[model samples]
Target: MTAYKSREEVPLNEKWNLEDIYPNLQSWEEDFKKVGNMIDDVKKFDGAIHGANDLYSYLSLGEELGMVYKKLYVYAMLQVDLDTRVTASQALLDRASQLGQKLSAATAFFNPFLLSLEEKTLQSWIEEVQGLKYFEDDLYELYRYKAHVLSKEKEEVLSQMGEAFSAPRNTFGMINNADIKFGDVTNKDGEKVELTRGMYSKLIEDDNRDTRIEAYKAYYKPYVQLQNTIASTLSAAIKNNVLMAKMRNYPTALEKSLFGDMVPKEVYDNLIKATKENIEPMHRYMKLRKDILQLDELRAYDIAVPLVKDVKQEISFDDAYDTMLKSLAPLGEEYVSTLRSFKEKRYFDVRETPGKRSGAYNLGLYGVHPFILLNHQDDLDSLFTLTHECGHGMHSYLSSKHQPQISAGYSIFVAEVASTVNEILLIRYLLKETEDKHMKKHLLNHFIDSFKGTMFTQVMFSEFEKITHEKSEQGEPLNAEVFNTIYEQLFRVFNGDELVFDDEVKFGWSRIPHFYRPFYVYKYATGYASAIHIADKLLEGDSDTLERYLTFLKSGSSDYPLELLKATGVDLTTPEPIQNALSIFSELVNEFAEL
Candidate 1:
């Protein structure tokens, strides 16, 4: 009963205007050309930062140019994402990517300049120049990586080559979202339904198992046919990781990944170890699913359904936003007031449309406000999603207001904390407010499922990614047969004996776009862990915890992400965060059992 077309057919209202970024493409283009011209100007001060005065001027100029580049990049990117079909938008994206490379190349001297200065000299510069006070922590963080930073030329080469280096990921995304087709599925009413990715999700989450299975199979059929292409993309991505690690003189890809966040190797290893030890919870859940559904066996398609059914409820977008405000009130009045503006201002693109990118994310940039992309539907799930993204928006709002623009962008390691914390708070808020047993059970299922997806499943993915890279390091060729065997083994490992591993499920990796992102999924697990810990602290209603949490949000990239997290009481470098998160998972499972 729904009519659909590409997003351009129903463009967003001006209410979601990005004119704050730039007035128009012409102005953006003008700024882009100005950036190209400023390349030479930046090169002049490269090797001449000798005295404190020179360093101050260099730092201030660098910050100003950085603000310019930030505005240009966010504008072009927002335009491209809004209507990806326009060739002009695609061209702008290409230009913006290239310009970003140029900007990085130009700014390469900042790190080396600081690295060259003795600690006392750097301190002298901070004291002598008031402008540099805001960025003292930023410079200190960069200096922490002085041992890892390569020669300026090598870093510049890496920066310029990054776009080409990330092509495999881009190709996989293009194929999966735009090119591949999932035919159609027969619905409960005997009507044939087209199996677009959006529709596929709706069908899989349906209360009917038959609809879930058929939709899952039909949806993945195209990926099965394109296995070779998918394998090639995976191979290229893995190879890129190995190549980059070697070039950077790191022992392995994992070291390079951990180094960026100042996370020790033990952090990654501990998550894998902790998940392996406690994986039975996931397996037990699978067994519970089989018993609940009265099935002889389960398959990959069965992974998404509720253990207790007939619990679905419809929630509208307006109601969802209102509920988010109610749930977030525990954080105090200022946080609640800012969240209200984001909701009323159309700060989010809240509905799914044809040709729109899938999933949700909060994009932050200097000077411009944070933007969130969401494929929202008016359900309890979507309401939780709204609360989640608003958490991110609010975090970005605070950081931008409290920190220098250069340090306002948070590291990915801690990025998920605010968003997931919002979800936790909302779940607790709803559970406290509702009296109906079904709604209570429904909310509990939602919380349990969040842990299952964000913590457990992503860790499984992190393991898969680690194993894939290790095999690639050992010179094993990543092809259809080899990759399928590995994928099947992981399925068995994660699903235990309860769920049968169907051969069709091997092609599932091809459908995932995140694998192309180097070691990114693990952050989702770490983020949730940090969020839950922070949420518990905030719920205590202690001023110190509240102030510390806010300070952590505003800390941004002022320090290594783990060090910043330590200030907030979550030590990602240790096993405790993962263990704590998993303990909550176990408790949720037991609670669900009692309910």
Candidate 2:
């Protein structure tokens, strides 16, 4: 993998074609001004809604303006993500953000107004206006939050405070992506150099214990040093969530976060509960790590190294993409071919550069194509990541293609199912294709580690989020010390007593970007379980399963996430899905032990 010193040095084919969104600053500026005018137009309807025609007018205009506004914001936001250190890009994004807040405040009256209407009046309006049919379902969905919705005035006030509510996340984004720097470590040439996230990924799994140790400490040094600062931002974020939950009349922050997805607290509760009841496999795997590595002590750094060290695989971006397409052939020719075109069309920003965001993600702009961001290193793990994100990309692409803008975006609750299904397919493909025993063992280890990361680790994080948010809700003080204690305790419970804790391990809570998004990680755990079932069925070549799964992707937010997954034959309301995933993990662990 080439180390790109700047975004310009990366190949054009490897970067996004932002021109797909906006051709130039002039075009972006025109859209910005147009959105401002549209915001003004929409705001005029605030005190004016009286009947069917008025409601239809407001809804249609508001939706149109929102579509344009999304393009403006995405174009600006994507540039900032490309190189976060750029002040001009930052300014552009700020403008877009403030515009979004204005749009939010402008439309805040709609929800409360809709909820205030009687069910009969709402139904009568839908009967009266043909165009209102486009927005009928969404308008009725407001009834679900009728108890939670505040007075129009208060809702407007809260909407105007959107940026204030998001400040901590924004501050942390700057800190994590653009400000914080990792310490130095000795590289292959025996010279010390400052570590980047890309480099740390490789170094952490180095065959040399000393190298892994050095990289681990150095990678964590900055996070530990800034622990209190990160803690402050995190505390503020959690407090903000709890505050919003209270203002919304929720029983708790967790419940409030789950409300949007229509996911019951039991689904959240059962995920953690089921995982803990089945956690012995995880502990057993940790002990297996110690035995296979022949170490008296296993640290957190020792956990990621491949137990099957005799096999090493290095995959370049091109090969990874080709392999990803091959693995996904089970999805069908159209699915494979469309995903192939996403690469040829430069849908991906594929290399790491200075000041780039550290991880991979797929952002689907409704009217535009899916833009995937990856800091891809040439390795097997990167191959999984490529497949993982393409799963998200395909979901985004299909969702936008099949549904109206209102229903085109899928819920976060089911988002991971798409991505993890892709990963399972890729790993299963590798497992089936490889003839060598060493390679198969490595693949098995990779699969086990992926399970640990996606399911177990996320469940651990879900529990951490739960505990921390509960503490805040209970009026407990949360600082660096409190975070450290909770995190270290969770780590010990999840990983078992086989490994000694590093001081840096306690500071693990400080590094996650996901915690900023409340009650979100649990979806990843749930999605992984749901994907395991769906992927296994697809592998069996069931045409009905394949069609339903594909439709589930295209269906997007047209239905609740659980209902969507249920259509694909994976139900999360019961513990069966989580338990089934755990069973697979246990079987894999035992299979590896015998090897």
Query: What's the lDDT for residue 288 in model 1?
Result: 75
lDDT by residue (tens digit), candidate 1, 1-595: 2234555544454125677677877888788888777776777788888777777777777777777877887777766666556678778888888887888778776676678779988898789878777767767877767777788777777887878888898888778767888998997789997877667767887877788888988988888999998899889999999988888778899888888677888888888898888887777877877887788888878877766677776777778888899888768798888888875666777667666677877887666678888777667777888888888888888888887777788878888888888899888888889998877877777788888888877887898889889998999888878878877787788779988877788776777788988788888898998888888777777678777877887777777788888888888877888888888888877777788
Q: Choose the strongest candidate by lDDT.
A: 2
How many angstroms is residue 535 displaced in model 1 relative to the true structure, after the best TM-score fit?
A: 2.3
TM-score of the candidate numbered 2?
0.99
Q: How far is candidate 2 from the true structure (C-alpha RMSD, Å)?
A: 0.9
Residue 291's lDDT within candidate 1 is 81
Q: Which stretches of candidate 1 lie over 4 Å from their true place?
A: 1-15, 48-50, 108-135, 540-543
